[model samples]
Target: MSGSFYKVECPDCENEQVVFGKASTEVACAVCGTTLARPTGGNADIEGDVLETVEAR
Candidate 1:
């Protein structure tokens, strides 16, 4: 079983970035440096709007 990916939209900058579903560390927006996701030892806590969920291929 593998984790998935997500396309998250930054609320402040509206920058779209690919984030790991089970990210071990904090994920920030590339353009605005805003916190996008936080690690919880499982699926990350997505802060911004989750545009899509990308399955592992």
Candidate 2:
């Protein structure tokens, strides 16, 4: 599947961030420095609360 953007809420500080669905690197929360997603072979492993899936415009 193609990569997409997702709005994620940090579990630690409730900070929101947009992250790539298929990110090849670790994604961290900008406010709290918490890990949000990890790189897998396919889709990224999401660790934060997913708010929504953003559509590419």
Candidate 3:
């Protein structure tokens, strides 16, 4: 089975970028020049909501 799509937020600029495929390292931000951990970044609002749902339950 394949791992679920995961998101990663930029720690520096708080920018978001989607990771459409498998795991990767050193994915750069499309807007900024920051080297992010993962390329899949859920927008701040979406990120928050997902977290909320998990926490609520």
Q: Identify the superior model by TM-score, candidate 2 or candidate 3.
A: 2
Instruction: Give per-residue CA lDDT, model 1, range 2-38, as digits (tens).
Output: 8899899999999999998889999989898999999
Candidate scoring better on TM-score of 1 and 3: 1
Which parts of model 1 are misplaced by more than 4 Å?
none
* Global local distance difference test of model 1: 0.91
Candidates ranked, most accurate by TM-score first: 2, 1, 3
All candidates: CA RMSD (Å): 1.4, 1.9, 8.6
Backbone clash count for every predicted candidate, in the order shown:
0, 0, 1
lDDT per model vs. reference? 0.91, 0.91, 0.41
TM-score: model 1 vs. ground truth: 0.89
* Every model's TM-score: 0.89, 0.90, 0.41
**Worst ten in a row by lDDT for model 2:** 48-57
Score candidate 2 by lDDT.
Answer: 0.91
The runs of at least 3 residues in candidate 2 whose Cα sits more than 4 Å from the true structure, single-residue gaps closed, are: none
